[model samples]
Target: MSSENQELRKVGLKVTLPRVKILNLLDQSDERHMSAEDVYKALLEAGEEVGLATVYRVLTQFEQAGLVERHNFDGGHSVFELDSGEHHDHMVCTETGQVFEFHNDEIESLQKKVADELGFELTGHNLVLYGKPKVN
Candidate 1:
Protein backbone atom coordinates (compact mmCIF):
# COMPACT_ATOMS: atom_id res chain seq x y z
CA MET A 1 0.00 0.00 0.00
CA SER A 2 1.08 3.54 -0.70
CA SER A 3 2.07 5.89 2.11
CA GLU A 4 -1.04 7.97 1.58
CA ASN A 5 -3.18 4.86 1.77
CA GLN A 6 -1.46 3.81 4.98
CA GLU A 7 -1.98 7.28 6.50
CA LEU A 8 -5.65 7.24 5.64
CA ARG A 9 -6.07 3.76 7.05
CA LYS A 10 -4.23 4.73 10.21
CA VAL A 11 -6.57 7.67 10.69
CA GLY A 12 -9.61 5.41 10.14
CA LEU A 13 -10.43 7.37 7.00
CA LYS A 14 -11.22 5.40 3.86
CA VAL A 15 -8.84 6.19 1.08
CA THR A 16 -10.46 8.30 -1.60
CA LEU A 17 -9.23 10.06 -4.69
CA PRO A 18 -9.79 13.56 -3.36
CA ARG A 19 -8.24 12.71 0.00
CA VAL A 20 -5.21 11.19 -1.64
CA LYS A 21 -4.83 14.11 -4.01
CA ILE A 22 -5.08 16.73 -1.28
CA LEU A 23 -2.74 14.80 0.98
CA ASN A 24 -0.25 14.51 -1.82
CA LEU A 25 -0.49 18.20 -2.53
CA LEU A 26 0.11 19.11 1.09
CA ASP A 27 2.93 16.63 1.36
CA GLN A 28 4.65 17.97 -1.75
CA SER A 29 3.94 21.67 -1.48
CA ASP A 30 6.92 23.97 -1.12
CA GLU A 31 4.91 26.33 1.03
CA ARG A 32 4.28 24.77 4.40
CA HIS A 33 1.13 26.78 5.01
CA MET A 34 -1.78 26.98 2.57
CA SER A 35 -5.36 28.10 2.74
CA ALA A 36 -8.36 26.28 1.31
CA GLU A 37 -8.60 28.75 -1.54
CA ASP A 38 -4.94 28.28 -2.29
CA VAL A 39 -5.44 24.52 -2.40
CA TYR A 40 -8.54 24.87 -4.60
CA LYS A 41 -6.64 27.07 -7.01
CA ALA A 42 -3.75 24.63 -7.12
CA LEU A 43 -6.14 21.77 -7.84
CA LEU A 44 -7.70 23.72 -10.66
CA GLU A 45 -4.32 24.62 -12.07
CA ALA A 46 -3.27 20.98 -11.86
CA GLY A 47 -6.39 20.00 -13.85
CA GLU A 48 -7.93 18.14 -10.94
CA GLU A 49 -11.74 18.11 -10.87
CA VAL A 50 -11.94 18.88 -7.18
CA GLY A 51 -14.49 21.41 -6.00
CA LEU A 52 -13.76 24.23 -3.56
CA ALA A 53 -16.26 22.87 -1.06
CA THR A 54 -14.67 19.48 -1.28
CA VAL A 55 -11.28 20.98 -0.58
CA TYR A 56 -12.60 22.70 2.49
CA ARG A 57 -14.29 19.53 3.70
CA VAL A 58 -11.27 17.36 3.12
CA LEU A 59 -8.98 19.85 4.87
CA THR A 60 -11.24 19.94 7.90
CA GLN A 61 -11.28 16.18 7.98
CA PHE A 62 -7.52 16.07 7.78
CA GLU A 63 -7.23 18.56 10.64
CA GLN A 64 -9.55 16.44 12.75
CA ALA A 65 -7.55 13.35 11.94
CA GLY A 66 -4.34 15.08 13.12
CA LEU A 67 -2.83 14.67 9.67
CA VAL A 68 -2.76 18.46 9.34
CA GLU A 69 -2.49 21.44 11.65
CA ARG A 70 -4.43 24.67 11.18
CA HIS A 71 -3.27 28.10 12.25
CA ASN A 72 -5.04 31.42 12.35
CA PHE A 73 -2.41 33.99 11.77
CA ASP A 74 -2.69 37.70 12.45
CA GLY A 75 -4.11 38.25 8.98
CA GLY A 76 -7.32 36.62 10.14
CA HIS A 77 -6.92 33.77 7.68
CA SER A 78 -6.39 30.13 8.42
CA VAL A 79 -3.74 27.99 6.78
CA PHE A 80 -3.10 24.26 6.92
CA GLU A 81 0.10 22.27 6.94
CA LEU A 82 0.98 18.62 7.34
CA ASP A 83 1.78 17.56 10.91
CA SER A 84 5.38 16.41 10.67
CA GLY A 85 5.48 15.08 14.27
CA GLU A 86 7.69 17.88 15.60
CA HIS A 87 6.48 20.70 17.77
CA HIS A 88 7.42 24.19 16.64
CA ASP A 89 6.20 27.76 16.68
CA HIS A 90 5.66 30.29 13.92
CA MET A 91 6.93 33.74 13.13
CA VAL A 92 5.04 35.73 10.52
CA CYS A 93 6.48 38.61 8.58
CA THR A 94 3.89 41.32 8.64
CA GLU A 95 5.33 43.19 5.67
CA THR A 96 5.73 40.35 3.19
CA GLY A 97 3.26 37.89 4.65
CA GLN A 98 5.99 35.29 4.92
CA VAL A 99 5.90 32.51 7.50
CA PHE A 100 8.85 31.02 9.33
CA GLU A 101 9.03 28.06 11.67
CA PHE A 102 11.24 28.05 14.74
CA HIS A 103 11.87 25.95 17.84
CA ASN A 104 13.35 27.30 21.08
CA ASP A 105 14.00 25.25 24.16
CA GLU A 106 13.95 28.32 26.36
CA ILE A 107 10.50 29.32 25.17
CA GLU A 108 9.20 25.83 25.67
CA SER A 109 10.61 25.67 29.17
CA LEU A 110 9.16 29.06 30.05
CA GLN A 111 5.74 27.99 28.87
CA LYS A 112 5.93 24.87 30.98
CA LYS A 113 7.00 26.85 33.98
CA VAL A 114 4.19 29.36 33.55
CA ALA A 115 1.66 26.57 33.25
CA ASP A 116 3.01 24.83 36.30
CA GLU A 117 2.92 28.05 38.30
CA LEU A 118 -0.73 28.35 37.38
CA GLY A 119 -1.37 24.79 38.57
CA PHE A 120 -2.48 23.81 35.08
CA GLU A 121 -1.05 21.15 32.87
CA LEU A 122 -0.02 22.36 29.45
CA THR A 123 -1.96 20.08 27.20
CA GLY A 124 -0.96 21.97 24.08
CA HIS A 125 0.10 25.45 23.03
CA ASN A 126 0.56 27.57 19.94
CA LEU A 127 2.84 30.59 19.83
CA VAL A 128 2.84 32.94 16.86
CA LEU A 129 5.15 35.93 16.80
CA TYR A 130 4.62 38.58 14.14
CA GLY A 131 7.36 40.93 13.00
CA LYS A 132 9.04 42.49 10.00
CA PRO A 133 12.25 41.19 8.47
CA LYS A 134 15.44 43.15 9.13
CA VAL A 135 16.41 45.34 6.19
CA ASN A 136 19.98 46.01 5.26
Candidate 2:
Protein backbone atom coordinates (compact mmCIF):
# COMPACT_ATOMS: atom_id res chain seq x y z
CA MET A 1 0.00 0.00 0.00
CA SER A 2 1.27 3.44 -0.90
CA SER A 3 1.77 6.09 1.78
CA GLU A 4 -0.92 8.25 0.24
CA ASN A 5 -3.40 5.42 0.50
CA GLN A 6 -2.44 4.87 4.11
CA GLU A 7 -2.78 8.58 4.85
CA LEU A 8 -6.29 8.70 3.39
CA ARG A 9 -7.31 5.62 5.33
CA LYS A 10 -5.84 7.10 8.48
CA VAL A 11 -7.91 10.20 7.96
CA GLY A 12 -11.03 8.05 7.58
CA LEU A 13 -11.30 8.89 3.89
CA LYS A 14 -11.86 6.16 1.35
CA VAL A 15 -8.98 5.95 -1.04
CA THR A 16 -9.98 6.78 -4.62
CA LEU A 17 -7.99 7.51 -7.76
CA PRO A 18 -8.83 11.19 -7.77
CA ARG A 19 -8.13 11.50 -4.06
CA VAL A 20 -4.78 9.74 -4.40
CA LYS A 21 -3.77 11.84 -7.39
CA ILE A 22 -4.71 15.06 -5.63
CA LEU A 23 -2.99 14.01 -2.42
CA ASN A 24 0.17 13.09 -4.27
CA LEU A 25 0.14 16.35 -6.15
CA LEU A 26 -0.23 18.35 -2.95
CA ASP A 27 2.48 16.36 -1.23
CA GLN A 28 5.03 16.39 -4.02
CA SER A 29 4.56 19.84 -5.45
CA ASP A 30 7.26 22.36 -4.63
CA GLU A 31 4.69 25.14 -4.43
CA ARG A 32 3.31 24.43 -0.97
CA HIS A 33 0.14 26.43 -1.59
CA MET A 34 -2.15 25.87 -4.56
CA SER A 35 -5.61 26.89 -5.67
CA ALA A 36 -8.05 24.43 -7.22
CA GLU A 37 -7.44 25.81 -10.67
CA ASP A 38 -3.72 25.48 -10.14
CA VAL A 39 -4.19 21.87 -9.13
CA TYR A 40 -6.41 21.14 -12.13
CA LYS A 41 -3.89 22.67 -14.47
CA ALA A 42 -1.12 20.55 -13.08
CA LEU A 43 -3.21 17.42 -13.40
CA LEU A 44 -3.95 18.24 -17.01
CA GLU A 45 -0.27 18.84 -17.71
CA ALA A 46 0.46 15.47 -16.20
CA GLY A 47 -2.15 13.92 -18.53
CA GLU A 48 -4.48 12.89 -15.73
CA GLU A 49 -8.06 12.39 -16.86
CA VAL A 50 -9.55 14.22 -13.88
CA GLY A 51 -11.94 17.09 -14.37
CA LEU A 52 -11.97 20.55 -12.81
CA ALA A 53 -15.11 19.80 -10.80
CA THR A 54 -13.53 16.64 -9.39
CA VAL A 55 -10.49 18.63 -8.37
CA TYR A 56 -12.66 21.06 -6.47
CA ARG A 57 -14.59 18.26 -4.81
CA VAL A 58 -11.46 16.33 -3.77
CA LEU A 59 -9.84 19.47 -2.38
CA THR A 60 -12.90 20.21 -0.29
CA GLN A 61 -12.85 16.64 0.97
CA PHE A 62 -9.20 16.97 1.89
CA GLU A 63 -9.89 20.15 3.80
CA GLN A 64 -12.72 18.52 5.69
CA ALA A 65 -10.53 15.53 6.55
CA GLY A 66 -7.97 17.86 8.10
CA LEU A 67 -5.41 16.90 5.46
CA VAL A 68 -5.10 20.46 4.23
CA GLU A 69 -5.62 24.02 5.44
CA ARG A 70 -7.58 26.59 3.47
CA HIS A 71 -6.61 30.24 3.50
CA ASN A 72 -8.88 32.92 2.11
CA PHE A 73 -6.63 35.83 1.27
CA ASP A 74 -7.44 39.33 0.19
CA GLY A 75 -9.06 39.87 -3.24
CA GLY A 76 -11.28 36.90 -2.39
CA HIS A 77 -8.68 34.35 -3.49
CA SER A 78 -8.27 31.04 -1.70
CA VAL A 79 -5.44 28.51 -1.58
CA PHE A 80 -4.81 25.15 -0.04
CA GLU A 81 -1.73 23.82 1.70
CA LEU A 82 -1.16 20.57 3.51
CA ASP A 83 -1.57 20.90 7.27
CA SER A 84 1.97 20.21 8.43
CA GLY A 85 0.98 20.80 12.07
CA GLU A 86 3.40 23.71 12.30
CA HIS A 87 2.16 27.24 12.96
CA HIS A 88 3.33 29.96 10.60
CA ASP A 89 1.94 33.19 9.21
CA HIS A 90 1.90 34.40 5.62
CA MET A 91 2.86 37.37 3.45
CA VAL A 92 1.18 37.92 0.09
CA CYS A 93 2.88 39.93 -2.62
CA THR A 94 0.23 42.22 -3.99
CA GLU A 95 1.79 42.36 -7.44
CA THR A 96 2.79 38.74 -7.98
CA GLY A 97 0.19 36.98 -5.84
CA GLN A 98 2.96 34.95 -4.27
CA VAL A 99 2.45 33.58 -0.79
CA PHE A 100 5.35 33.41 1.60
CA GLU A 101 5.40 31.62 4.93
CA PHE A 102 7.16 33.04 7.94
CA HIS A 103 7.58 32.41 11.65
CA ASN A 104 8.53 35.11 14.16
CA ASP A 105 8.75 34.49 17.87
CA GLU A 106 8.68 38.19 18.74
CA ILE A 107 5.43 38.69 16.86
CA GLU A 108 3.98 35.63 18.51
CA SER A 109 4.91 36.91 21.93
CA LEU A 110 3.47 40.32 21.26
CA GLN A 111 0.16 38.83 20.12
CA LYS A 112 -0.05 36.77 23.29
CA LYS A 113 0.74 39.79 25.41
CA VAL A 114 -1.94 41.86 23.75
CA ALA A 115 -4.48 39.09 24.18
CA ASP A 116 -3.68 38.71 27.84
CA GLU A 117 -3.88 42.45 28.43
CA LEU A 118 -7.31 42.38 26.86
CA GLY A 119 -8.35 39.72 29.37
CA PHE A 120 -8.46 37.02 26.71
CA GLU A 121 -6.19 34.03 26.40
CA LEU A 122 -4.93 33.49 22.89
CA THR A 123 -6.29 30.28 21.42
CA GLY A 124 -5.34 30.75 17.78
CA HIS A 125 -4.68 33.39 15.15
CA ASN A 126 -3.90 33.90 11.48
CA LEU A 127 -1.85 36.92 10.41
CA VAL A 128 -1.32 37.74 6.73
CA LEU A 129 0.63 40.76 5.60
CA TYR A 130 0.37 42.19 2.09
CA GLY A 131 3.17 44.07 0.42
CA LYS A 132 4.88 45.10 -2.78
CA PRO A 133 8.57 44.24 -3.14
CA LYS A 134 10.90 47.21 -2.78
CA VAL A 135 11.97 48.47 -6.18
CA ASN A 136 15.37 49.41 -4.92
Candidate 3:
Protein backbone atom coordinates (compact mmCIF):
# COMPACT_ATOMS: atom_id res chain seq x y z
CA MET A 1 0.00 0.00 0.00
CA SER A 2 1.12 3.55 -0.70
CA SER A 3 1.70 6.20 1.99
CA GLU A 4 -1.68 7.80 1.29
CA ASN A 5 -3.46 4.48 1.60
CA GLN A 6 -1.59 3.77 4.82
CA GLU A 7 -2.62 7.14 6.26
CA LEU A 8 -6.24 6.46 5.35
CA ARG A 9 -6.07 3.04 6.96
CA LYS A 10 -4.61 4.58 10.11
CA VAL A 11 -7.70 6.79 10.29
CA GLY A 12 -9.86 3.69 10.99
CA LEU A 13 -11.14 3.16 7.44
CA LYS A 14 -10.79 -0.40 6.25
CA VAL A 15 -8.43 -1.07 3.39
CA THR A 16 -10.74 -2.27 0.65
CA LEU A 17 -10.50 -2.64 -3.11
CA PRO A 18 -13.37 -0.25 -3.83
CA ARG A 19 -12.06 2.55 -1.62
CA VAL A 20 -8.61 2.28 -3.11
CA LYS A 21 -9.95 2.25 -6.65
CA ILE A 22 -12.09 5.31 -6.08
CA LEU A 23 -9.23 7.17 -4.45
CA ASN A 24 -6.93 6.35 -7.34
CA LEU A 25 -9.47 7.56 -9.86
CA LEU A 26 -9.88 10.87 -8.06
CA ASP A 27 -6.15 11.21 -7.68
CA GLN A 28 -5.63 10.91 -11.43
CA SER A 29 -8.61 12.74 -12.87
CA ASP A 30 -7.89 16.01 -14.72
CA GLU A 31 -10.99 17.91 -13.71
CA ARG A 32 -10.59 16.71 -10.11
CA HIS A 33 -14.21 17.50 -9.34
CA MET A 34 -16.52 14.54 -9.80
CA SER A 35 -20.02 13.78 -8.66
CA ALA A 36 -21.15 10.49 -7.15
CA GLU A 37 -22.72 9.54 -10.45
CA ASP A 38 -19.51 10.47 -12.21
CA VAL A 39 -17.53 8.12 -9.95
CA TYR A 40 -20.12 5.34 -10.32
CA LYS A 41 -19.98 5.60 -14.09
CA ALA A 42 -16.21 5.54 -14.04
CA LEU A 43 -16.24 2.42 -11.88
CA LEU A 44 -18.64 0.70 -14.29
CA GLU A 45 -16.58 1.76 -17.28
CA ALA A 46 -13.50 0.36 -15.56
CA GLY A 47 -15.35 -2.93 -14.83
CA GLU A 48 -15.41 -2.39 -11.08
CA GLU A 49 -18.34 -3.86 -9.11
CA VAL A 50 -18.70 -1.14 -6.48
CA GLY A 51 -22.17 0.34 -6.05
CA LEU A 52 -23.14 4.02 -6.16
CA ALA A 53 -24.02 4.02 -2.47
CA THR A 54 -20.56 2.75 -1.64
CA VAL A 55 -18.95 5.49 -3.68
CA TYR A 56 -21.02 8.14 -1.94
CA ARG A 57 -20.26 6.66 1.48
CA VAL A 58 -16.52 6.61 0.84
CA LEU A 59 -16.57 10.18 -0.51
CA THR A 60 -18.39 11.35 2.59
CA GLN A 61 -15.81 9.69 4.77
CA PHE A 62 -12.97 11.26 2.78
CA GLU A 63 -14.54 14.67 3.12
CA GLN A 64 -14.85 14.33 6.89
CA ALA A 65 -11.23 13.26 7.05
CA GLY A 66 -10.09 16.35 5.05
CA LEU A 67 -8.83 14.18 2.24
CA VAL A 68 -11.40 15.62 -0.18
CA GLU A 69 -13.26 18.85 -0.70
CA ARG A 70 -16.85 19.08 -1.90
CA HIS A 71 -18.36 22.04 -3.72
CA ASN A 72 -21.89 22.97 -4.63
CA PHE A 73 -21.62 25.21 -7.65
CA ASP A 74 -24.32 27.31 -9.24
CA GLY A 75 -25.75 24.07 -10.56
CA GLY A 76 -27.70 22.15 -7.98
CA HIS A 77 -25.48 19.09 -8.09
CA SER A 78 -22.42 18.61 -5.90
CA VAL A 79 -18.86 17.90 -6.99
CA PHE A 80 -15.93 16.41 -5.08
CA GLU A 81 -12.23 17.04 -5.63
CA LEU A 82 -9.02 16.00 -3.97
CA ASP A 83 -7.64 18.42 -1.40
CA SER A 84 -4.66 20.17 -3.04
CA GLY A 85 -3.31 21.55 0.28
CA GLU A 86 -3.00 24.99 -1.32
CA HIS A 87 -5.31 27.93 -0.89
CA HIS A 88 -6.94 29.06 -4.13
CA ASP A 89 -10.30 30.12 -5.53
CA HIS A 90 -12.69 28.76 -8.12
CA MET A 91 -14.22 29.99 -11.34
CA VAL A 92 -17.29 28.12 -12.56
CA CYS A 93 -18.64 28.06 -16.10
CA THR A 94 -22.19 29.21 -15.64
CA GLU A 95 -23.34 27.54 -18.82
CA THR A 96 -21.77 24.11 -18.29
CA GLY A 97 -20.86 23.96 -14.59
CA GLN A 98 -17.20 23.39 -15.47
CA VAL A 99 -14.75 24.68 -12.85
CA PHE A 100 -11.34 26.27 -13.04
CA GLU A 101 -8.87 27.09 -10.25
CA PHE A 102 -6.87 30.28 -10.10
CA HIS A 103 -4.94 32.47 -7.67
CA ASN A 104 -4.11 36.15 -7.98
CA ASP A 105 -1.66 38.09 -5.81
CA GLU A 106 -3.47 41.35 -6.55
CA ILE A 107 -6.74 39.94 -5.34
CA GLU A 108 -5.13 38.57 -2.22
CA SER A 109 -3.58 41.94 -1.42
CA LEU A 110 -6.89 43.72 -1.96
CA GLN A 111 -8.63 41.25 0.30
CA LYS A 112 -6.09 41.86 3.04
CA LYS A 113 -6.50 45.60 2.72
CA VAL A 114 -10.29 45.36 2.92
CA ALA A 115 -10.12 43.11 5.94
CA ASP A 116 -7.67 45.42 7.67
CA GLU A 117 -9.95 48.38 7.04
CA LEU A 118 -12.77 46.43 8.62
CA GLY A 119 -10.59 45.58 11.64
CA PHE A 120 -10.81 41.88 10.97
CA GLU A 121 -8.29 39.16 10.27
CA LEU A 122 -8.73 37.53 6.88
CA THR A 123 -8.43 33.90 7.89
CA GLY A 124 -9.84 32.34 4.71
CA HIS A 125 -12.36 32.91 1.98
CA ASN A 126 -13.97 31.26 -1.01
CA LEU A 127 -14.17 33.36 -4.17
CA VAL A 128 -16.16 31.80 -6.99
CA LEU A 129 -16.63 33.74 -10.19
CA TYR A 130 -19.62 32.62 -12.28
CA GLY A 131 -19.81 33.70 -15.89
CA LYS A 132 -20.18 32.57 -19.49
CA PRO A 133 -17.20 32.07 -21.77
CA LYS A 134 -16.40 34.83 -24.19
CA VAL A 135 -17.25 34.14 -27.80
CA ASN A 136 -14.54 34.12 -30.38
> Which one wins on lDDT?
2
Stretch of 10 with least lDDT, candidate 2: 69-78
Clashing pairs in 2: none
Order the candidate numbers by TM-score, best to worst: 2, 1, 3
For 14-49, candidate 2 gives per-residue lDDT tens digits of: 999999999999999999999999999999999998
Candidate achieving higher TM-score, 1 or 3: 1
Score every model by TM-score.
0.96, 0.97, 0.91
Q: Which regions in candidate 1 have their CA more than 4 angstroms from the true location?
A: none
lDDT of 1: 0.95
Clashes of each: 0, 0, 0
After superposition, which runs of candidate 3 have C-alpha atoms over 4 Å from their true positions? 10-12
lDDT string for model 1 (1-136, tens) is 8899999999999999999999999988899999999999998999999999999999999999999999999888899999999999999999988899999999999999999999999999999999997889
Which is superior by lDDT, 2 or 3? 2
Error of 3 at 46 (Å): 0.3
